[model samples]
Target: MTTTTELRVATDGLTKRYGGRAAVDGVSLTVRAGEVYGFLGPNGAGKTTTLRMLVGLVRPTAGTATVLGRDPGDPSACARIGVLIEGPGFYPYLSGRDNLRVLCRYRGLSDAAAESALERVGLRARAHDRFRGYSLGMKQRLGVAAAMLGDPDLLILDEPTNGLDPAGVAEMRSLITDLAADGHTVLLSSHMLDEVQDTCDRVGVIVAGSLVAESTVSELRGGTTIVVRATPYPRALAVARDVAGANRVAATDTGIRVDADAGVAPRLVRALVGAGIEVFDVHSSERSLEEAFFDMTRGSDSTGDDPEVSR
Candidate 1:
C-alpha cells in the first residue's frame, strides 16, 4: 500500500477552467517518491494545466492538490520542487554555467551548485559556451541543469524534449532515466508516446481535458499473447483450443491466437507437433503505448480554449 509520505504529488478531482469550458477536468493522479511519472496527452490536452496547478503557476478552479505534502505554490513546497515549463529563459550573452549560476543566486544557492548541475546534465564541457551559440538540445539540457541547481526533491518538466533531433531525444531520455535512478522523483509531460514508453515507470494519459487512464507502461500496453501459425489450419486450431482453453483460443486469418503468456508458447508448439501439425511461426504480440493510448481516447478531440492558450 502507498502512504501519503510516499507520494511526492497527489491531486483529487483537480480542475482548471477557462471562461465556461474546463481546461483540466476532475483529474486525480499520484506520483510516488523516486519514480519517473509521465503525463501524456495530445496537443491542447489538459496536461500542461494540471502540471501548472501542481506547481502553483496556475490555480485550480476546483479540487485539491498536494505537492510534497503541502498545498500547491506553498513556499516550502516550492523550495523542494524544481520546475522547467515550456521553453527556458536565459540571457543570450551568458554562458550555460553562468546562466545556472544566476538562477542559483536567485534561489540563494552557491555557484558550486551551478557547476554541479552542469556536470550532472553533461554540460560541463560546454559550460563556457554562450547560450546563443548552443544547439536546441544543448539549451534544453541547460534548462534541466538549471532546474537541478539545488538538488530539489521533485522535478516537474513540461515537454523537455519538445524540439530536438533523434540524438537529442535519446540524450534527454537517458538523462531522465539517470535522474530517476539517482533517487529524484520526476514528473515529465510529453506528447511523444515512444519517449514516454521508454522512459516513464508509469504514465497518466489525458485526452480532451480528462484523464482517461493511469498505469505502468506494461499494464497499459496489456499482456503478451501468443500467435501461432501451422500448416494444418483446422487441426492446429483444435489443438490450440484444447491446449489453451476454448475460451482463450481464437482463430485468426493465418492461424490461432492464444490469450496466454509466452510460457504457454512451448506447450502450444509441442501439442501441435505431437498432433502432426507443422509449426510454421510463433511469436508473442504486445500492444505498444501508442496503441493503448488510441484505445483509451478513441473518441476524444480537443477544441478551442486549451490550457496553453489560457496560460
Candidate 2:
C-alpha cells in the first residue's frame, strides 16, 4: 500500500568506514511512511552506526541517504524527525515532567508540549516522579516521551526495549503500535530477533556490516505448512504423501509436515482417517524468522565480527 513517494527513509549504497575497516558497507534500505520498520542485526553488526548516519550524529563515508525526503542531517528534515538513540539522558534529580520541560525550553517549545508528551506515553499519572526513582519501563517510556515532544513525523529509536523485563517490553511494544496508528513512521533498531519479528511490519536484517535480507516477516519465513500428528506413523506418512504429494510431505520428529496451505489440512485428515490412521491433531505452521535469520547468516556467528564496529 506504500508508494515510493511515501518513503520516509531511503539509502543507496550507504557506507561508513572507521579507519581501514568499514563499519557499514554499501547498505541500501527503505522505511515507508506510517510503518514500524525494524533494522535487525546482532551486536557489532553496525546497526547503531547506520542509525547514527540516518540521524546526522555520524557522517557516512560514501553513498547517499535521505530522511523525510531531504538529505540526512538537513535542518529542514531534522526538524521533522525525532530521535532517541543510545537511550534517554535526563538529570537524575529532576522529576520526569520537569526533565521534559527542560528539553522543551532548550528546543524553544512550550511547557504544554511536555505535558502532552507525558500524556501520550501514559506517564502523566506519575509525571512528578524523580527520574532516578522511576522503574526501568517508566524511564524508557519517559525517553520516548522526550522524543515525542514535537510530535515529529518520524521516530528513530535504537533498541528502546534493550534492558526491560517482560512487562516493560510489552508496554514499549504497545507504545510503538500506538505511534504508528497515529500516522508516525518508526525506524526501530534492535539485535533481538524475536522481538523484531513480533513488532515490525517489515524488517531488514544486517549481518557482518552487510544487509542480507529485507522483507515482511511472513514473506521472509516463506509459505505456510500443514503439520499433522497421527498414529500408525507409516500409514499416515503414505496417506499424507498421496494426498499432499510426496515431494511436499516430510516426516518430522513429532508428526508429518506438509509444505502446503491450511486448505490441505482437511483433505490430509480425511485421507489419514480413511486409511485407518488415527489423527491426533492437524495445524498449519510457518518457518520462524529466527530460523530464517540463522539460515541466512549461519557462518557469521563463529567467524565473529569486528569489535570496533558498534551494534
Candidate 3:
C-alpha cells in the first residue's frame, strides 16, 4: 500500500518559560498524517508543556507551531484538531451523552455526530450515566470520544493512559492504533517507554525540555545484546575482554556476562569456542524501550555534579 506524506503538525524552535525558568526549551518536531507519533520524556521533562503549547492552552515563549498547515493557536486551526489534555472536563451532574452534547454545542456539532462519537468510544451503552459515576477508564474513553466528535484530522493526547489498569491501557493502545488505521494523525505524549515503543511508528524523546533523539523504534534499538552461558569462567572472561565493543565482561557462576555491541553475538560465540570453553546456551538480551530511553537521557539532569548522589 502506498502511504501519503502529509505534514499534520510541525514546530519550529518551540519554547515555553515560567518565572524565568525554561520549562520547554527550543524544540522542533513533526507529526506526519496517518502516523502515530510518540512524544516521550520523564517527569518534569517538559512533555506536558510542549503539548499545551501545541494545543494553544499555553502560548509559546519564543517559537511557532503549525497544525494542519495553519497556526495552531488560531481558532480555525482548532476546528481541525482535537486534544485530550490532563483529564476530561465534564459536568458532574450531566449524563455522559449530555456532556458530549454540550461540547458539541461549543464546537457547533450536531446531535447525530455526538451520538456517533459516543458509539465510537464504546460508551453508547453508558451514555445515559452521569459523568460523576463513571470510572477513570470510562472517563478516559469519554475524553477520547469527545476528541473524536468533530471528525478531527489530527488528535493530540497527553498521557492518555495515566491511571488505567493493564487491560484499560491495552484497550487505549489498540484504540489509538485503530484511529491511525482510519487515517487520523495522532501525537501521543507518554512517559511509558514500552507503551510508546509498542504503539508509535516514530518517536521523539525529550530530556530536560530539549529534543535528544528522534527515530523509529527499530533504529533506536540499534543492535541486540546477548548473554551466553559457558564453562571455564576465567578463559571466557579473557576472551570477552578482548572482544571490541564489549561494554561489560564479568565472570558468573555458570558463564561470563558479556555486553557486546549489536551483531557481535555470533563472533562472541566463536571466540568462546576458540578459547576452549564449552558453550551451553546463547540468548539475546533485548534492550527494553525503558533501557533505551534511559540511555538517550542518561546524563541530561540539570543539577550540578555531585559525587555522592546517584541518578
Candidate 4:
C-alpha cells in the first residue's frame, strides 16, 4: 500500500447507487503523487460514476474520498483538480479559443491562462476554429486544454484517446508522460490496455464496479512465462512438463509456453538440451496486460450493476 503522505487520491468503501442498483460498491483506491494511474474496466463498469464522484460531479451514496488531502466535494479541493470527463463538450458555434475564454471567465482566470493551455495542448494554431469544425482529435485536445487552465496538480481524464488517430494517440501518450515527469498526478480512464501498460505507472482493474486488482504496471504483469521453440516439438513439451516448479507448460502452434520467470529460464533450456532436444531460442516475458485483464474478468459480469431506480 502507498503511504498516506504520498497519496493524492484516496477512497474508502466508496459506493454509488441509482435507485437500489449499485453503480459502484465498496471501492477503495489510493493514487500516489507523481504517478500516471490507469483506471480500466469494460463498458457499464461504473468507471464514469467513480470518476464523477472523485471530481464532485456525482455524489457517493456511501463511503468517502479525499483529493489533495481534503474532502473531494470541498470547493477548494475541487479547484486543485482538473477533470476531462465524458469527453470534450464545448459550444459548437464558438471558436475553440472563445470557448476556453468563456471557461476562463467562469473560473476567474485571465486570458493568459487560456492561451497557455491552448499552447500546451498544441491547439494554439487552431484556437480560432469553431468547435463544430474541429476534428475529433482537436476536440479532444481542447478538453485537455480546459483541464489545464486551472494549472492543477491532479488531472482526471476519461477516454482521452477515444477519437485520436494513431499519431494523435502517440502525441497524447507523450503529453501524459510529460505531465507525470513534471510531478503531476494523473488518473487516466481508458479501455486501451496496451496504452495503459506502456503509459501508466500503476493500474487498477475494475470489474462489476469493484477494483479487482491494483498494482504497478510491472507488478500487474505478475508471473513470467518462458516461451521456447525447438526442432522437436513433442519432446520439448515433454521435457518442459518434467521441469520442477514449472507452472503451466503448454504447447502452442509456434512454440511451447512455460509459466516460469527468467530465474528458471536457463533451467528449462538446459533440461531440453540434456534431453537431446535441439533448443533454438528461449525467452521469458510476462503475460500481456490484455491477457491478464481478460483472465481477471472472465467470470465477471456487469449484470450485478442492475440499478433499479429508487428515490
Q: Pick the candidate with the highest lDDT.
A: 1
Model 1 CA deviation exceeding 4 Å by range: 303-307
The TM-score values for the models, in the order shown, are 0.94, 0.90, 0.83, 0.89
Q: After superposition, which runs of candidate 3 have C-alpha atoms over 4 Å from their true positions?
A: 1-5, 237-276, 297-311
Whose lDDT is higher: candidate 1's or candidate 2's?
Answer: 1
The most accurate candidate by TM-score is 1
lDDT of 1 by residue, 95-170 (tens): 9988888898899999999988887777899999999999888888888888777889999998888767887788
Writing each residue's lDDT as its tens digit, candidate 2 over 174-261 gives 8889889999999999767788788899999888789988899889999999888988898899999999899998999968999998
- Scored against the true structure, residue 138 in model 1 reaches a CA lDDT of 87
Model 3 Cα displacement at 193 (Å)? 2.6
Of 3 and 4, the candidate ahead on lDDT is 4
lDDT of 4 by residue, 165-232 (tens): 88888888998999999899999899988999999999998887888999988788788877899868
Per-residue lDDT of candidate 3, residues 1-311 (tens digit): 22223788888899887767777788988888899999987667787778887887788889988888787678888888889987888999999999999999988889998899887777899999999999988898889888888898999998888777888788788889989999999998887778898899999998777888888887776665567777776667777778744457766664666666657778888888988899888776667778888888887773322111111
List the global CA lDDT of all models.
0.88, 0.87, 0.81, 0.86
What is the lDDT ranking, best to worst?
1, 2, 4, 3
Q: What clash pairs does model 2 have?
A: 48-311
| Candidate 2 Cα misplacement greater than 4 A, ranges | 132-136, 302-310
lDDT for predicted candidate 2 compared with the true structure = 0.87
TM for candidate 1 is: 0.94
